[model samples]
Target: MQISQQDVHQALERGEFVPHFQPIIRLRTGQLYGFEMLARWAHPELGLIFPGDFIEQAERDGWISELTYQLLRKGLKEIAPLPGEPTLSVNISPPQLHGTSFVDQVHEAAAEANFPLNRLILEITESALAEDIVSVSKTVQSLKIAGCRLALDDFGTGYSSLLHLQSLPFDELKVDRSFVSSMTQKHDSRQIVAAVVGLGQSLSLTTVAEGVETEEQAEILLWLGCELGQGWLYGKPVPAEQLDEMMKRRQPHASNAILNGMTGRQSATALEIPPMQRFAQLRAIYDGAPVGLAFLDREMRYLSINRRLAAINGSPMEEHLGRTVAEMIPEFFPTVRPLIERALAGEVVAGVELTKPTQNPKELRTILLSYEPAFDESGEVIGVSVVLLDITPIKRAEEAQRESEAHFRHMIELIPQIPWIIDPEGRALDVSQRWLELTGVNDDQWRGFAWLDSLHPDDRQPTIDAMHRSFQSGEPIDIYYRVRRSKDHPWQLLRSRGSARRDDNGEIMCWYGSLEIIGESDAGKK
Candidate 1:
């Protein structure tokens, strides 16, 4: 539904409007990077509304400038408390740019919040500028001179061309999310990415691929020479609290996971960003390559590596290239040395999972690796192409799963009463056969769907609703409901206590609860 200007003004007056931030990554380094400020509205009545819904209406009603001002003002104030100065990209509407004093207002907002002008990236779309080149150019120049970086957002889908590129004084180009989103499935999309990267380089401007959704696409963009990227592949738009926590964490796992999700279904090509002349030639031939290739000098210093190789190494090409293995990462020497030595000895090493430590403790304590020798034309060993795969998170996840299982069993065994774990849907994940034996129910009747059938029909709805509320609100829950042994038996009280598991963003991922027979204890007290 379209929101009226009065609604927009009222929401603004009531302080319902706010900015949501999405991260922008330095394609090479998987670090806690910059953010883009996206507008959001939390209407008292509408509940939650996206910027697309009301922003244009506000713009059309001559309140676009005020909205833009509010967004920038809010964005700067929120970022003021962050540990380090973070780059913030704020969207600029066409109307806001038309005013002669808009640039000055931007300066005023930055000064008001004591924010650094250099940290602000004013993102304007190509379509927005297409209609009035003269005014847009003036606005762009004004923003640039004020030390605010200008970015041409959504470059490919609109009126994008060499002329627009030449006329606009933008320091960055955000390749549209549409192209980045489809890069995995569409061959034409990949071609478009390659073209944009090439154009960005020739223009001497930083190219940021938006909507990078997969490890494969990130690898391809790096190979195609893109320097930066932003998307769900990197991270979804988050609130100030989440973004601050991410910065505090100083890692981008969630962001990277988002990026990986974008390209999960597409075939990934390994990037060859290494300077090695030989590896460069090999990269042209390897389509949808599975193996990671890298070239090291005599001292085992990395000279060049492909995107696959970099992913194997734990970063993007820009961050990995031009640095020695020891310089980029010294801990790898422990596991990497033996393999390098083997390659130097004219032997090909294979299938070995070498563990290398990362300087950052948050980065898995160690990295796993494998490698092969890069032989010269004379078949003489030169350098080793080290292939690193980060199995740390996976390994930790497995370990956590095992520990959870052990803990679950211990909790079940320790409790004298029948114990069971149930999910949000009130379906049992684990249940003790003791409860089944007490009720004379077969093991088959106690698992999964059958277990839910045991809940007394009169009490089931309330219990299920309580569990759903817990899952939705992320609140601790305890419910006492009745379970029937059979149609002939009286129902017994079952008390369940549970909590929700959420991701870093505070979204509920799953809910787990444990049930205990409370009837006996209540009877003893009575």
Candidate 2:
């Protein structure tokens, strides 16, 4: 049945469109990780209506944006008070995401609510990937910069899902309910789920299974190495109040079990064991930890060093034992002494990035050093625990990113013409120095769609429409527009032309354009 615009608008006015949150659980220990906010209409006569029943009509009637904004505000308000750092995932349609005001709206909502942007996850359907990917990628990058995570919802359901996964910066990949619901009974579904989990693992993304309604399905997902899950087995989408109750009822042990599993340990059991046995277990866990670990005495001599720490220092465990950091790394002793003294004074210092010279003087490694004071039963500082993490790759990546940005800025500044780069969403990511100077606008004013503010009011809409057309069609854009140089100066007619920059796979990455003064064209006279 078709829903009228009046009905939808009335529902909005009545505040009937609300968020129903479904629990997303950790598959390993069945702990509640977060909730995916699903939209539902609390209809007066027709009873509760799901998005499937009216979302298309809402979109057709131009009410989808309002609906999404309402849901976002409602979801954030509802989830803000929840305990245990639960994230709220809200679904975003392509049209809403592509709008110029979308990011601003999100930022405003988050700021108004004082919500932690990192705990908010915006989920986009895989089908949305079929839209102008360049715009989507840019929007994704902006969202990430704002500290909100993105998820590819219903992943593997669309034809270009893989491309979306590869091109976008999605932090999570949600396996489609179709695959999760049937994986237990269907061999093909099982294979698809396994493949998706494997792909997520390879990409270092969190994998979530949807529509897991049975223990068997959940078990299969766990066995397949899926990290998270959501379905009826966990709970149906419930109202905020009910969700609060459910959260209260959730067992703390479940979270503990999940954390232990994450640390490669089974559910911890209470046992009456000798102190020596307990010490051995702790030593084993510490030695096997992924990071380099070492224990030093009050005098800053190495009492024990794990193999990982030894390797990071370019030495063996035996050589590190009973030796001061100066003896092991004399070159770095000057830098290490202060941190050791601070740690010995019961101050825990961490995340100190420093250069560590290896045996090969030509090769210097960047490492992050952290020191924690160890205490005895009498509450006296006995020693310091040192952790060394090799960060050479991270440092190199940062340096490369800096160089790329510098080079891009240099090229743009050298160009005489007013040049700009826009993402598929028509948001300006880069504007040349000439363009900024011509408009007398600062960097902040020239970013995103703010460049439109410098355009003649009469020409802004047409230019935007033309850019949208070019983005959708992946064609070159050639448009003439009047831009304001200053308050005293008249609008200057300028012609701008740009084309899509595509990757090897023919996907649009960005649009580059340059503007030139048109010098009183016949059309400008009009």
Candidate 3:
């Protein structure tokens, strides 16, 4: 059914176009990261109307830009003074993004709402990139320059998603719900979601899964390394007033129930079941869990082991059963014995990282272990439940990163001048040791646009504007500024030059630059 253009315009005029907010959760910590504002039409006669009911009509009528601006302004204003001041994400259609004045309108709305531009995220659907890529890219760049983050919504649904990702500057990618909802039922869907999560991680983008409705879906998403999630399981989109109440009452661990496999509320229900049925349910959960799980007797012998734990031990389930730590893996038995004793004594032993000798002698594996005591009806500890997580890959990644940083530091220290690196967005990534020594600033002081604080007060804004322009244009930078040698000293003039470091695809990865001391009078000459 098609809606008349006049109806949408009339609704807009009556202030009926409002925003409903759905929370986006960070899966790693299960905390509220932000919210996505969805447009809703609170019609008097027709009851509440969704965006789908009128958005297409509004777009065809050439008033989608106006509708978007209204929604953006309302959403920002409602969320700006939120208790924690969480980030607000507002959607924009392709037409709006392609419009000549869209970026200006966004800035104006943000200003009117007294919202910080950096705390706002503008989301464009993947399908919107089907046409006018160049125009959309220009608008996106301008919005980023004004300090609003960009997110590609419903990312995997588009035909040219890879192309859009390559050409655009998206800080976040929201995986479409079609894949997330079917992941458990379809093997191929699971693979696709995993791949998208991996792709986002590689590109340094936050990956969010949308339309999650079940704990199972959320658990799978967490296992796939997706950073954030949105769906009914977290909460349905509600009006600003209800959302405010929800935010205030939301507990940090509320959304993490799936991460722990079940919540206390669910556990209470489980206790009401018949003993046989409860055991069956528990067995199913244990077998299906992604991490290693084992049940140990007071004597520290394995009574039951899940497939994951068996695989990690490089042994079959039968072999692990009735075997003590010393009998199975003698090399690390001394280290494991104390942890088992502690758990049996009703104390939780967690976050213990153990380097154990695997079946392959040449390779040592890193494993993280946690133990929880199981209690009887009398409240006496009967046994222990052990969770073992293989963290070899994570440890290896950390080691490799340290080595890479050390190598880069050595190379930078060799240079006599102060060097720095900034990402494509002009946020500082690293600075040379000479920079810290000369400015009398610590490493923390030089990270993420904080390097600007080291500059003389008068030269800061001009330098920032010049760098922003250079970043947008991919041009070489040559500027002179004054820097303080120390807190007690006067400012000294310095010249800095930088060039864009492009990838094989000719996209700017970062800006590499160095600073050299010039004559004190050089600042005046410039």
The per-prediction CA RMSD against the true structure, in angstroms, equals: 26.8, 33.0, 30.5
For residues 1-526, write the lDDT of model 2, one tens digit per residue. Answer: 6887788879999999989999998776667789999889999999988889988877677788888888888888878877788999988887876746788888888877778999999999977778788887888889999999999988887878878888888899999999987776676788799899888877878888889888777666765678888888888899877986888786622322345335423522222233356678988998899889999998889998889989988888999899888999897889889999999999999999998666789977899999999964224687998998999888889999999999988886776677778898888998777777677798799788898998877889999999889888888999988875676666678899998999999999899988888764333332
For residues 348-429, write the lDDT of model 1, one tens digit per residue: 7766655555676555443455567765422456677666555667778998999998898777777766656665565666
Instruction: For model 1, give the RMSD to the true fold.
Output: 26.8
Per-residue error at 318 for model 3, in Å?
33
Distance from true position, residue 73, model 2, in Å?
0.6
Worst 10 residues of 2 by lDDT: 264-273
lDDT, model 1: 0.72
Deviating ranges (above 4 Å) for candidate 3: 254-526
Cα distance off (Å), candidate 1, residue 481: 99
TM-score of 3: 0.50
Query: Global lDDT of each model?
Result: 0.72, 0.82, 0.83
